[model samples]
Target chain A: MGLMETFFNLDVLHSSALALLEGLKLTITLGLTSLVTSFAAGLILVLGRLYGPMPIRVIAIAFIDIFRAIPLLVLLVLVYYALPFVGINFSPFWAAVTALSLVASAYAAECFRAGIEAVAIGQFEAAKALGFSWTDMMKDVVLPQALRLVIPPSTGIGISLIKDTALASVVAMPDLLKQALQAQAFYANPSPLIGAALLYLIILLPLVRIVSSIEERQKRAAGR
Target chain B: MTHQKATQPFIKITDLQKFYGQFQALHDINLAVEKGQILALIGPSGSGKSTLVRCINLLEQFQAGTIEVDGIEVKEGRNLNKVRAEVGMVFQQFNLFPHMTALKNVAIAPVRVRGISWEEAEKKALALLERVGLSQHAHKRPSQLSGGQQQRVAIARALAMEPEVLLFDEPTSALDPEMVGEVLDVIQKVAETGVTMLIVTHEMSFARRVSNRVIFMEQGRIIEDTPPEEFFGCGPKTDRAQLFIRSVLQGHPDAGLTAPLQVLED
Candidate 1:
């Protein structure tokens, strides 16, 4: 009933350590898979929005609008539960990933589009004048510069997606949050949730620092 | 300097017309640029000098008429890459690729378009940079270089393609007054290489010194197309050309205030 006994109970912490570790593994796997898939999907959407013919552009726009408008939890529930009635049932993990990646791609596409637009018109004109085809121009000139420009924001999206992975617990994925809640119920202690929170901080703190430093460098570069 | 025969036109434009929405930007423009000729286009702002030069490279498509560079007509549906590679354009803004080094800026086109080896492209690019007196700044990015140096690097980039003709759309117009001389000096050196060039410039003296021919445009029309000496000297043919010459001379403090008086006297 002391502060240390209540908040930092080593006995409870030790008991929940194994469950927390398993949850961490799921969190990492989900994060990495979702991140890669979302980034790829986002780039495609960005390209479609920027350079596609009319039909593709309209499709990209519609997809982005719908995914971004829905909450990730609602998306997860719909994918995991509602899709079973449509004969397209998915596992909890896959449902979580699909929802997360879809929403993340929508946001990431907007970030990437902004980055591309931030590049001056002259760069495109210069690339064209230098006899670069559209593909070469985008690959060699525009994308490199634009990706550099959007690093800070893209990292922000990454951190956000990382946190949003916790929402996968709603679909019974046995991810970090779900495992932590289960451990808390079994031990009748809150320490597992705190441990999970600490684990998240440990993983994300370096990334947060990296993003800030990158932003600082970008600011100084802009000033120059 | 030997001039190409009058019969051989390297660049020929006939009945060129351009419009932006309802406003006419160029009207009934006809011009011919012989090979190796340094032609200076001088005109007041809003006079279509830039538009006409841009049309030569098909940067701005004309509403009507044809532009032929080395007898390759510029029009819709043509593969412009080949023709564009043959004609290098330097913008007034010195649009250097900010991400690349000076050497890379000059080397990229050859490597990307000409399918040359990187080493060969860099070798040619370095020689061009040296020609422009920017060899020391080869590793520097465009942002690190001064405006004049960036423009010089742009000229080197344009030259690295070994284009048959170079287009200058107000090359010196974006430079600081002091830096203008350095860019013009490099341009003067480029002129001596016998490459045909069309320069839209406001530097009347520099144009007089470098141009074989001078074109005067007004209200989207060419008012005078004559030798530089005649265009800059004893008389400008039309009253508008005369007024322009007087105004240009009068604006230059170096003109000693008597030059405009002489034109007025005439």
Candidate 2:
């Protein structure tokens, strides 16, 4: 029962490793689906802030502020537990995705809005002078540049989204952390915790590299 | 002046007035440009020179005025689509869409605004980009290129719309000194093709070199309007024009038409 032998215990490690692998798929699925939804929703919200009529702009601002203020854990508990009584039952898998995406979208929207506005006012005028309509301005010029400006932040958001998937385990979605917990319970050893940590690291490390490299390039470009 | 008979006075501005909340930005401005003529709008920044050109395409909706481009009468809330299609405008910032390659940036209005097929629009975009001396940079995004190259791309984007008149809003003002020459060169080439142009610029030498007529505006009014030759160097008809020339030459743009001189002066 020495720390060294416990660390290398093949049986405990094997159980958790298998469970981690099984949970990895759901984690990825949740991350990707919610990421896409958040991106789309965020983009629209940014556009609303920029060009929408008064009511629309107000709604967008309010949505972004309110959700951003709320804790993600509270949002999750509500979507998973409270909504069912109101007749909005969803599987724990979907509940986690919905809650995460809503919060993510709020933050993403703010990021995009700031990015879009970061483009010089002259860019918009140039588009108009060049005979582009409002929508064409976004499709051709504004969003493209703004998206580049926002890319590093958005990728950083992805890491948070992936980590956030761990919260899904609380709702019984069988994501990696939850499986790790179950394996620990079954094997009666904490060695499985190491496997879980390894899985989180494996998923997050490359992303960290990508985020930093891209962010570095963005900075270089900005300096130019 | 060998003013083109068929080419006609392609642009006419009548009684254009603009107010920004109670402050007047442009007041009772009037101007005219014959076909193939290069008209330079020269003045201090807030002199309403840029505002006038922007109004021709309704980029800024004037409180009261009428603008006729070619044969089309432009007024408030009227259909500007056709007028914008026929008139090309370039801006100082060279707002080529950052998301697009120079080629895609050029092709967008033609494809979307003008309803041209994407392939056809792209072909025209490439040719025009070449004309502006940016053929090599057609596939690069705006950020990847220098300011001069981006402005040329902006020019190419405007030309792709095939407008009868091109507008330049201090096209070289935002450029670095080294980059100004290249963008002005592109503009000069466009002028050579006999397309009509209206430009607002502070590059006094450029205004003289490229303009057939240079108009000086001050405090939302046309202080003086004269041919390039008379607009610079020396003059009898313009006490205002002579004074503007000497100040601009000495790099003292103090003729506060937009912002007061103190902030820039001391």
Candidate 3:
């Protein structure tokens, strides 16, 4: 068979489309769930590391360091396969989410820390002089500015998280990559895998473009 | 108003000592500022003038001293927000919230900290912007405004809190020469409202014109404290102050010193 017929077979793609669609749904669900959990957890981790009491700060630092150092695939396997030995069981879906969130949260925390530290010291003093409580200052002044500063990097993390959802296939969550592999075995064609790659590109390319545009806009704002 | 003696100082500091690591920033400072008095603090760089003003509002912690603002003593672990609410500070950098417009910058503290409604806060903020002659520019962000306008907005933001005392820490030192006049003009108007003020400034002429009293500091101590007329007229009482004033006059030809040679001879 020619390359197009073997690798990009329209007949195979049409036949396997439904299965790929099912996988796409699960992939999106896992990616979005992990993205949200990681972002929220990242914010908490950063706040604790920066402002919490000594014990909390130490725990936050340790968590970030450990998760960031460990390979995500190893952590995923351990969470799925090893945790049951200790009687802590999670479903394949949850295991993937837990592993992804742990690692992504660490990266997100570092991104947030960088954004927060970039804020001028004068901003803190200004908020304090205005009688804002520490919480109010963080919520109303510091975080808002930091959020603006962090969008590009944080979205970069989100894109990576979305791409990393493919790793969920190893846990038998039947995400896009898993579905494509199954389709390839059933029909003896690589078309479904190409289709899955196309779907990922469709979702992530716009996000990549958005990050660059935001960065450009921020640069222009700074220049002004 | 609570019944208090007319002789009581509105803000008082006694034996205040501040340190940055092992280096002393302020030494044995004692000052009592009456209500409605505008005092200008002037000194050479590193003379602790900014440090002294900053301590009044508890922005800088002193190693040993007492600071009393409106009868409340400032110290560690106290609810300093209440004291800060009563004392407004305008920084040399302006420090306006870059993300907020001028009106929002003026209104945020009142709405968030003072518990005023947003409508009321915005109304007061607009009025303050008008007072600062920036009412039309209220919708503009700090970056969109010139240095003078940003500083005016900052002054308005501080005034919106309705503090009894205002601290200006070299408020115009960061502005261009042309922009300085507009900001100082707003501050001069703020002074007319009878809020007690302490200004750290290098503008000798403005201090002489705007302040009832002038303080000179050298090496973490107040070298001279006298009425502006006495301090600027007969020159400073101390030899160091005399030499400092002479050098300042020669450095800035536009300090409103009519005769540099005459002051140098003194």
Candidate 4:
């Protein structure tokens, strides 16, 4: 086959596009649930670090550091494979969700911590001066500012979570890549994988652009 | 919580001492302010003016001695929430939350801290924003405003707490040369309402014009506390005070009332 003929088969592309589209629901579902669960967990970690007791903060910190150090593939395997031996079995879907959330929250914690630390010392002083209770200080003053700052990097993490859904296929969750694999196996052609890669790019590129534009607008607003 | 309106000085600092890793930041600092006095603190950087102001509300803890605000003595386990609530501070950085609109910034303290309804606090915030000449920009974020406008919003935020005393730490020091006047005007208006103020500022002329007394500090100790008239105008008074006066007079030859006051730092 000619190089163009191999890389650009319309039949392969069409079949892959249809199959990947069929898998789209699982891909998006995993992405969104992982993003949310991990963000909630990350919030818990951040708050634990900020206001939790010293030992609790230490444990949370270790969790962040440890999860960040492990490979996501290795971590996914552990969740799906190792835990079942201990009778803490997670179904494939839960295993992927659990593993991705673990990885995502580690990054999310770092992002959130940076955002919180960016708030000035004077703010806490002012919060105290305003008669805010400790809870009120976090809810009213610190969290609002910190959350706004986290938006851009956070969206980047969201994009990463979406991309990471491909790892789910390794655990047999049958997401886009799996469908692409099945299509390629049936047709004895590998071009559908390239088409699948193209589809991933399609999903990611615009989200990155949107985050960049939001970042730009924030900078302009900050300048005023 | 119930007491007669103070016949005694509202804030009293008696032999207060603070140490920063064995370096003394405060040295037997004894000071007092009547309920309505506007005291201006002037010093070189690191002279502990900001530290002293912070100690008043226990924002910075002192190692030994007492700070009394509204007749309550500083104690480690004491409920300081009331004292803190009744004293407001404006920072050198303005410190308005950049993501928050001016109205939201001003309203947050009252609503969250005092448990006031948001609607009521926002109504008051709008009125206070107008007082500081920022009503038109209430919906804009702090990052959208000039330094002067942001500082005014900060003052309005402080005022929203209805503090018995307002503390300013070099409030206009970070401002552009042209923008200092508007913030100082808002502060001046706040002072006129008999709000006790302990201000740390480099604006000698503004200090002279607005403060009832000027305090000069060096090396964490007060060198002189004099009416602005005596503090700024002479030589050979004390070698240090004389040196300070010359520096001020030479640097700001037209600093006092004689020059048409432009709010510029120059």
lDDT of 4 at A39: 98
The ten-residue window of minimal lDDT in model 4 chain A covers A3-12
How good is chain A of candidate 4, measured by TM-score?
0.93
Worst lDDT run of 10 residues, candidate 3 chain A, spans A125-134
lDDT of 4 by residue, B73-124 (tens): 7655546887877889898988887667999999988887678899999999
The residue-by-residue lDDT of candidate 3 on A43-146, one tens digit each, is 99999999999999999999999999999999999999999999999999999999999999999999999999999988998999988989999998999999
Worst lDDT 10-window in candidate 1 chain B: B255-264
Q: Write the per-residue lDDT of candidate 2 for residues B1-266, one digit (tens) a residue.
A: 23335655678788888999999998888777888788888876687888888888887888887788776777534456667778888887776767678899888888888788999999888999888888988899888999889888888888888888898988887877789888988888888899989899877767778889878888889988788776564552667666665566566648533212221121
Relative to the true structure, candidate 1 has a C-alpha RMSD (angstroms) of 3.6
Chain A of candidate 1 scores what in TM-score?
A: 0.97
The candidate that achieves the highest TM-score relative to the unseen native structure: 3
Evaluated at residue B67, the lDDT of candidate 4 is 88
Interface RMSD of 1: 1.1
lDDT of 4 by residue, A1-224 (tens): 98766777788777677787877778888899999999999999999987799999999999999999999999999999999999998988899999999999999999999999987787777787667788888877888888888799999999999999999999999788888888889877878877788888888999999999999998997696
- Of candidate 2 chain A, the 10-residue stretch with the lowest lDDT total is A125-134
- Model 3 TM-score, 2 decimals: 0.95
Residue B151 lDDT in model 1? 98
Task: Write down the lDDT of every candidate, Cα atoms only.
Answer: 0.88, 0.82, 0.91, 0.84
Displacement of the residue A82 alpha carbon in candidate 4, Å: 1.1
Off by over 4 Å in 4: A1-19, A215-224, B1-8, B73-78, B226-239, B252-266
Off by over 4 Å in 1: B1-8, B76-78, B252-266
Collision pairs in model 2? A141-B97
Residue-wise C-alpha lDDT for candidate 2, range A47-134, written one tens digit per residue: 8976899999999999999889999999999999999998999899899989999999998998998788898887877776666677
How well does candidate 1 score on lDDT at residue B132?
A: 94
